[model samples]
Target chain A: MEQTLRRRQPGETVFGYALLLLGLFVMAEGYRIDGLYSPSSAGVFPALAGLVMTVSALAIIRRIHRMRPAHIPEGSGTAREFVRRTTPADVAVMAALMLAYMLALEPVGFLGASFAFLFLSIFYLHRGGLLTALLVSTGSLAAIWVVFRVLFTVVLPSGWLFR
Target chain B: MSDSLSYFLMAWTDPQLLLLTAAGTFAGIYIGAIPGLSVTMAASILISFTFSWDVNPALALIAGVFMGGVYGGSRSAILLNIPGAPAAIATALDGFPLAKRGEAGVAIGLTTVCSFLGGFVGIAALAIAAPAISEFALLFAPRDYLLLAVMGLLLVGSLSGESLAKGLYAGALGVALGMVGMDPMTAEGRFTFGTVQLLGGIPYVAAMIGFFGVSEALAQLHNLKAPRIKQDVSRILPSWSLLRRYLPLSLRSSAIGVVIGALPGTGGDIAALMAYDQAKRTVKNPSRPFGEGAYEGVVAPESANNAAVGGAYIPMLTLGIPGDAVTAVIIGALFIHGLKPGPMLMIETPHLFWFTVGNLTLANIFMLVFGLSGIRFFAKVVETPPGILIPLILILSVVGTYAIQNSVVDVYWMLGFGLFGYFLRIYGFQVGPVVLGMILGPLMDTSYRRAMISAGDDPVAFAQEFVTSPLSLVLALAVALLVISQTPLWRGIRARLAGG
Candidate 1:
């Protein structure tokens, strides 16, 4: 059967170009490590991988160029549509919350950080009210604590603040 | 022989092991049936939780999970038309149609029985074939190992994602990531840039959790509002006549599953697809038109994918090469337990082999019991909105990452990779090759270095050895053929041949 070409996703071209740059940087790093001293040099395999990456990235760009652009809905700019389609408000908020949770894991500890992140994110995503989110998050946190900390004996961070 | 039998029955006879196996299988079913939650993600996370336990218990739980997870994917596929895992993508084709026709119960029952049968075939193959393969694998040289790794990566890249280039890019990127930290051979930092943390290399478990777990959760955001479809299921147990009728097709699909699953880098997803395709072509008269709702359609994929569970283990146990993504993660678990997977693994720890075989057999039994009994509960479970599930998964990802060595740095790595992996997914790139590449990268590097050193660092001599030795020649040819087949020239030639 003939393969169908899917409409190119928004930001695909830019992503391809970014990957290409990464490949080039890696290639340069590979060269910096060892200047093609020998086939068995520490840098050789990495260099080969970088070269493959570079070549593939260029191929990806070429393929992307052949595809038609995505159809933006009426009354929406392409850039705005791209962001909305790829990373909607909920996703963006969740991502930001994830970043906060990770940063707070040490200072705020697993329990505090996780509870807050879970409750807030669930409340935001679920939109079913705050009390339910609080109950769910708390129950979940307790279950996780019991499972990992108590039963499995994993040493979760106690937080310097708590100490 | 008697000792092997004893080991094979170990899980069945032991109470703790039996309970763990049953529990793992039960959990695995739910995991596999839930959309956005995958066997690979669950297995990777489970490894961290189980890391400190005895190797036997750890293996038992993981084995159950592996067996159950493969079969469980069909549950959601049948009920919701959303494949719980990639392996059940084909199952959803006819499974959902059957559900729509109010034969959801019958469909699930047939799928459960066939999956059980296929699981048996796979285990039987593993029991019979792995030791023999391990013996042969013992004769492999470093060059041959390199060729095998290359072949695996090439197959994974070409078979998955939108384009070969994208696959290759993801794979090479993984190889590059694997090269980070200290050079295993010389203890010199390769990509550290003088950073003390970089010297330890990126923790692979972190990478696995991020790429598979976090990235998947982020991707699920796209379909957060997709309405859940409800189906009433009744009478899940298939009649004996129904079983006898589909037995031949299930067996045939199971055979296909074993061969495809045993191939390194490929897994149940591909096996199920091929089996479904094969069934479409071969089965002369179906209960219905191939797509409209055929019993064979559901039977082929479910059976094949479950059978693939056994097929996937053969390479990981015998050659230290993963048959697919889950096995790749399992390899990490094996390493953590101080067990080396390869030919020596079989020779040194023969009991582990038999115990696994037995455990998988037991898991299959549990899969059958759980799969048939819990249709109503499973329907409700699949309806659990991604809104709640995603947060839970994120929390699990964090805990799973932290559990591995309790390193905050690894958690950061997980987050970073997760975000990057999400973008990669959006761009139509598969993250499977990236993880597979990471696992195989160091193996390829060390193998290449060893092969080169043996040839006195002469590129020509190293190249010459590929063809001079019989084993290496076969592997070299296989690799070359794999690469060539992905090229435009090969496609053009094949098209010409087909047209004429």
Candidate 2:
């Protein structure tokens, strides 16, 4: 059995819809403030921007459909295919870890939160070296704390734990 | 004349001042080479530390940092594909590709020398033609400024990666984002959605770091184990023949830099992009095609941005208006020193003007010395393992974003844009236009509205003003040419003309 090489681009449909929704929302927001009747009104520029965005998004959708038949296979699990193609598992994990770091930041303090985040990230990426991760994370956080707090006099968040 | 001569040579004679200037320039180059650390940030930080010192020493250090930082931004741009500051955005376009091909050292060396040459041109203008240039800058009307902003946005056509439509959408999106916050004209909220923090709008600095720094970090996670490129450090200094060849282009870009930098609300970023665009249109046979490691691409932006340092001072010393953020900080320093910066400044404190020119001259010389010597070391720095470098970049992005206003919310915005920008990059959209839009969007909006209001709500009157005013008409014609140059018809005509 011979398999043909198929050229496919990812996320056009998703991107187009996202942009369309954003354009409509922005347009509605513009109207809610000031009606678009007056060109010099506060809403005029934003409304025009929304209109351009919406039109461009429609064009993107049209372009995607025009190009899709030759590339993306028409079959089951298409959404899964897009997910796999667009967001590989490694990237998703890193992104999730970043979000987690942000959330834990204020509560855990700069040093506390940053150290943990750094260590976990480095260790995971380095494939689990306990001592190196421990040393690397601590040293990096210390350098930052000294530079920002002691030298520059910036008051970084102490968080509940450290202060 | 002799008093002015004494002022010009003062820094060279004073040991403390010369030492401070040299130290400041050296630190600035390193700080500027680091991702997420900008010249503006360093200048602002120095203001606090140097507050108690005498004004002359403070000014010398800040001036050195200013010159060094502007040139330093290109180091990271060439080596890492991450712009150290907004002004270096254009530098990274072709600089990164050159680095990937192991030509990073030559790129760095060429940009450094061009930057020095450009700096000299800017200083020459600052010294000789400052008064006349400032008077000319004052002649620009609101409509003219609007045309300039539009002209900048027009470059999105060239910078847009694969699709013009995608670029337009991104640019419009950026414009809309910039429109958020209270309308400066009235107290009316435009896109605030009742948020108090957003009353000031999204910080473009944070947006810059996220799009270029954090987003690039996220993108790097895909090939975390990919082999790093080894930069060639053998030919670090550019040859005299290469310098001789591009001398005309360098001088033209420096002039453009000075003019744009002297304009209020414009800065090195705009000048760099404009110069890069000009090079693209004019250089019929480039060493390489642009966005693919063209030497002209690196030279045009690096030279323009550094020259902008001197150009920025032109307005501050003459008109009391700041040319850029760093210059604005300098204005504050001047105020602290009990000197007012304006037209009166040139006459009343001629010594200050001459002193600044001399100081910048010394800084530019130091910039050349420091910029050329560290190429091999800089190349080795960029070869850090991705596993180490990527996380380091993300941390620096967060820290830099937070440092802007000490606002955690800004960090969140950086992360948000980082994720969004990562997706955009994956989809073949260049992140440059988005940042370009964010930077230029507010300028465009405010200028357009002001120009409209000046016309008393008369659309025809407002439109006519573009053709009626000589300066506006010139800008209008430039904008028209920019549009025509982007069209297929113009390309076809040019091709046919060349064939004939």
Candidate 3:
């Protein structure tokens, strides 16, 4: 079934239509703008660009429709495969980790937040391994900190906790 | 020459400068070796830290990162087929193949030497040719610049996968996307959708991070199984015979690197690819076609990309126009330090120029040392499970984005683009053109419009002026040929002509 799609023409057709719609939308926006050569006008380039886009879209549609059929599929199923392969669980975990890091950034400061972020990330990467994650996290943070703050004399963000 | 020698002597004698060079090289290498961490990011991050420091040390640090980072990207390209930066894209073509054949040590060693040689060539070019190049660069009117940009856009045909039409579409789309944000000629927003934050336009760095870094991470997550690479602990030196054989090719590639690097917006990545393509076209009795472990393939790109660093600085120092994004940020750093880069920069700040030249040379030497010593450690990274690496990459992306301006909005933008990039990649859209578009778009737009206005809105007059100017004519022809060659009809005609 996947192989069949690779030989089919639907993908290009879909892409062509998408481009057409986008071009139309841009053209509408371009028309709504003021004069082309005016100092504060926005229409000139957009109108030109929209016309080009629309022509290209029409060309693509014609080209795809006229092409000879091959033995292979038209679509690679790459999009579907990618969506299927990316587990919701993995995304959720990563999102949760990022959220935690953002929340912790100001309160924990650069060092603490970075340290925690590094640890959790490393831990997640290492699959919740405590000792290995701790070692890697501590080493990475210490190195970054010493290099940026001490050697380079960089003023990293310090929170109230550190003060 | 005497003055340059004296400057070199000063650099040699300054232990503090030497230490800074070493540190910068180290940082650049580490940051560059990581898949998502670009040299631009490393340099930008260093800016806030170096904002208060003296100009010389700050320059020394940034130069080290620039040199080291350019060289560092090859590590992953060789070991994992995943280029650490855009500059390393060509390196992966042959570098990974060599690694697969258990010649990783030799490949790395060859690249290291080539990188150093490339750097030396670039610095030499910068030192000798900057004034002359700057004079030439000034001749590039808006029409010429527009043509040059079109030529760059044409490269999408070569870079895009398989389909020429699809590539052009993507390239056009990229250019259209670039037209977003506030128009340069007029203060009105073109595609900002009436947003205040977007009034300043989409940040190129953030877009790059999203397109390359985050999208790559998302892709890597799909393939969690780490391949067991055979570690061949061999002598980490290319044979003298091998070096002699490839010396001419390396020199040619380095020359290409320097020239492309000098061109604004086109940097190490394009140089590397062009060099690789040239080498493949010319080399006889190759071990294999590229992407099959050819040593020359690795050498050409590695040398060229490293050399491009020197090429990029010429315009930056001579005209105050950055050759690439990294240099743009460096220009900001220079301005912050009360140093303006322009025609009289050499006369006003000759010492600073000399110091930079010296620093670049030293950075190349340091790249050789760090590159060889850290291979074992970096190879270990490729061995890590993708599941682990992917999450860590995300964290780095988030932190790096936020750290840029300390703005949450940037992070949100990054994530939005990241998801968009991931989808695009899945649907077979190439990101390189997008990046190229983002970087070159505004320049093309501003320059063309300004040129038009300067030409009194007379299209015929603009054409006449453009054709009459030798430089503009050359660039115009090149752009025309480049665009035409990519069209299917032109390609078919060319093929038919060859057959005839």
Candidate 4:
């Protein structure tokens, strides 16, 4: 079988450049840790690692530059295509829910935050209506609470508001 | 000999130990088969709970989990395209294709048998080769360790993903992430950025859950509407002829698993990947083309990964060096139980060594029984709609992260890494190297520093050591060849050589 080349993703160039910037920033931080006065210094490995990352990012950028431009879907611009491909509605919404759940964990507690996150995500994604989402989320939450809290005895965050 | 024999049979004779082993194996399978749950997470959590227990029972339970978890990864790899663990990444190359072809039953059956045989090979090797290999392992100097870590990163980087460059970047990024804490030797902060939370460094378990678990859940969103594949369950057990046909290959792969697993800073993921690569090269006739539902493809990785469990114990039990992340946790448990685990422990507590060998053997047997019996039920997991499954996976990821330290900060880190990993995946980058790099980075950093210090901080001396020391030279050469093999020049040469 013949090897097939990878098709370019729409925003791959931007992502590659972002990585390059991150690599350079890491190199700067590595240098700031400790100068090259001693080989045994902790900064040396981090610096080396950063250097490798920078070089690899450059190489990747070059490869991405050489690839054929990604094909935009019909009647859509490149930005739209990139958005649709990388972060579609479902992913964006789910990610938002996750962020919200994480933020709410301390204030709302594990039980409240988890229930809301699970119920809302299931309802939106599954589109099976409210009762199905409610039942599934409640059941899963109960199981998780029993296993992790009651059995494992993990000290989950209790809401300050509740207290 | 009789004493050793009786100690070896300890778990088998004790009722509580027997039950624990069986339960641990059963739980390990589900834990490993679940998308967000991992053997490392389970082992670490179990450590916290079981630290107060007697060493024998705790060891038995952990051993069972380790054995079963390694094999369990292949189940998800075959049934769904998502690998349950990094080791199963290679299994999914062909296993998922087989599942798509309605041969999920046959694939699972073949994988189960091969894994059992492989587990036996690893256990037998552990029993026979532990002392000898530990002696060999002791010769690995800091520089040699640095070389081994480099070789591992390079190996994983090249094995997957769209290009070598992307893989290298990911690996380096991981190393950088691992650097985000106080320097071990100097106690000076490296990348703490004046933050108290950053002083402890990023929780790698959180990184692991994010990259492997949350990222996968997000990726599955693309296929939420896609219907699940209908599996044929008529043939759950492989024919005797089929087992006989693959026996030699399974044994060969198991040997590969054992060696890689025995090597410190390496584990089943690398072993399975290498075995898959070896099978791709050696097998003249496969059930089908590799990456297109080949039976040999599934068999090779399944055998190698399970064998790695046994291989992983050798260094942990005999040398005090963990064979893998799970073994590292097991080592901590050993310490908690007031036992040291280095070479002296093998001599001082010979019965412990014997008991472990016996316990691992029992776990292997339990793995096979538990692995095969639950297939019909487990296979149904893949049929679960992505809509519901994705949310549950995310919750598990969050809980797994929180359970590590009860810190909300880790949950945030996990989500951040998950988003970043999702972006990487979309752009055709492999996240495996990143995880491996994170795991190996601190080890590599310390080794590099120690080697440099030993070389008196002279670059020329450090360079010279690579070629002068026999072990260093071999590993250095291996790293050189691996790097060269990934270049375009090497690929061109290979194609020309093949054509000629």
lDDT of each: 0.84, 0.84, 0.74, 0.87
For residue B86, model 3's alpha carbon misses the true position, in angstroms, by 4.1
Docking class of 3: acceptable
Local accuracy of candidate 2 as per-residue lDDT tens digits, B34-96: 887788888988898898899899999999999999999899998888988878889999999
| TM-score of candidate 3 relative to the true fold | 0.83
Q: List ranges where model 3 is wrong by over 4 Å.
A: A1-16, A27-163, B44-54, B77-86, B92-106, B231-235, B264-266, B273-297, B332-340, B490-500
Best first by TM-score, ranked: 2, 4, 3, 1
Q: What is each candidate's fraction of native interface contacts (fnat)?
A: 0.67, 0.54, 0.19, 0.81
Which has the greatest lDDT?
Answer: 4
| Weakest ten-residue segment in model 4 chain B by summed lDDT | B378-387
Task: Pick the winner on lDDT between candidates 1 and 3.
Answer: 1
- Give the per-prediction TM-score of chain B: 0.70, 0.97, 0.89, 0.93
Give TM-score, chain B, model 3. Answer: 0.89
> Can you write out model 4's per-residue Cα lDDT over B1-500, one digit (the tens) per residue?
99999999999999999999998998888778866667887888788788888999898888888888888888888886667788898898899899988899899989988999999999899999988876777788999889988877887788667888998999999999988888889888878988887888988878978987888789989988887887886788899999999999999999999988998877898889888878987899998988799999999999999999889889998889999889999999999999998888979999998898888889888887887787888777677777788898899889878987889989999999999999999898888888878888998999999999999999899999999999999889988988888888888898999999
TM-score of each: 0.78, 0.95, 0.83, 0.94
lDDT tens digits, residue span B202-228, model 3:
766667667766777776655555565
What's the true lDDT of residue B475 in model 2? 92
